[model samples]
Target: MSKIDLRKNIVQYMLERKQLAHISARVGIVLDITGSMQGLYKNGTVQEVVERILAVASKFDDNGALDVWVYDHEFSRLPAVTEQDFNSYVTTQILKNKNIHKFGRNNEPLVMEDVIKKYTVEEQSSLPAFIIFINDGGAVKSTKKVIVESAIQPIFWQFVGIGNSDFEVLKKLDSMEGRIVDNANFIHLEDISAVSDEMLYDQLLNEFPMWIQAATEKRIIR
Candidate 1:
């Protein structure tokens, strides 16, 4: 089926199941778009990895709000301030000039900082917000520790490793057994960047169901 149709069907299915309410999650996606991501991999190109991520994020059909933000160091500066600016960076800056940035190499610090700033001081009395960080490597600055420490409590952080970068850092941070992080835990992935388009699609298709399971457990969806 078409992407739109698939998304609509998924949403409709959840609604019919009375579980749509449980799917309400404010998901914030922090994507790294540095130049090094363009490196050749055994499975596919770096661009392919990015496309896969976008596809996964876009295909998410839950009722919870979705915010996708991408960061790259080519524009100079550690973090790009303002969502409007960050959005513009993806559509205008990065889309127009794709040669300068690598994926996770140089953009981690900026992206992390930007993400933290986006929801750091917000007063959340209801549901906890979900933040997913997908990068290929490490951070440039020591911003993660400070941001993680200062950010208001009760935030769920997820890290997805894309390339040859060290995923051990993610393991150290994750407290949960599964990918679901409850109340200030980290969830991460190893290098799944080398998969082909078909493989990537299958992987994502398998993973999407977990989002529903987590949302249900959290009572975000029915």
Candidate 2:
């Protein structure tokens, strides 16, 4: 069978079984670079997890569009984040503060608001947008407010808790009674140790196909 047919079948199965969201969603990642993420793993480290996320994102780029935003209260203080700025920001700002494990960092929590504002103003397109927020800590009150405000948008907010993060924050983000608002449901990993290399790889491989199914249903990528 053709790849397209395979993808369709997968989508159908996901809808029937996983109740998974759509495919053509434009994925935007907001990773928390706090001080705590420096926690290590057996093979390599949590940095490996970060690398895995980047790798998965690269794969998704082929399926559709992908963008990553690494935030800390400190990083946001420097300047506005741009696609062009990711490199320097990573080198000077991120590496300077964050250890290989990546925890206990701060950035303007309001920066999320800025990102949403900039994205809305800059792009007038109608593609589905998904925000995959990877954070190990709680946001300040202001940041939480902005996140709650931004949740009102059509963006599918997926929270992935890194390390031993409190699930309550993530649950609040994902909670939406009637529509996709009033809550932010997230994909969480309670402990970094819980993810083996093989498991991570399998999850990464499945993510794109599941997203494609959701996208096809929403008519975003096609």
TM-score of each: 0.53, 0.58
Question: Candidate 2: global Cα-lDDT?
Answer: 0.49
lDDT leader? 2
Each prediction's Cα lDDT score?
0.46, 0.49
Q: Which segments of model 2 are wrong by more than 4 Å?
A: 1-22, 39-47, 55-65, 76-93, 96-108, 174-183, 196-222
* Residue 107 CA displacement from its true place in model 1, Å: 5.5
For model 2, residues 112-186, the per-residue Cα lDDT tens digits are 765576456676446545566667767554555666565445444556666665655455643433432332445
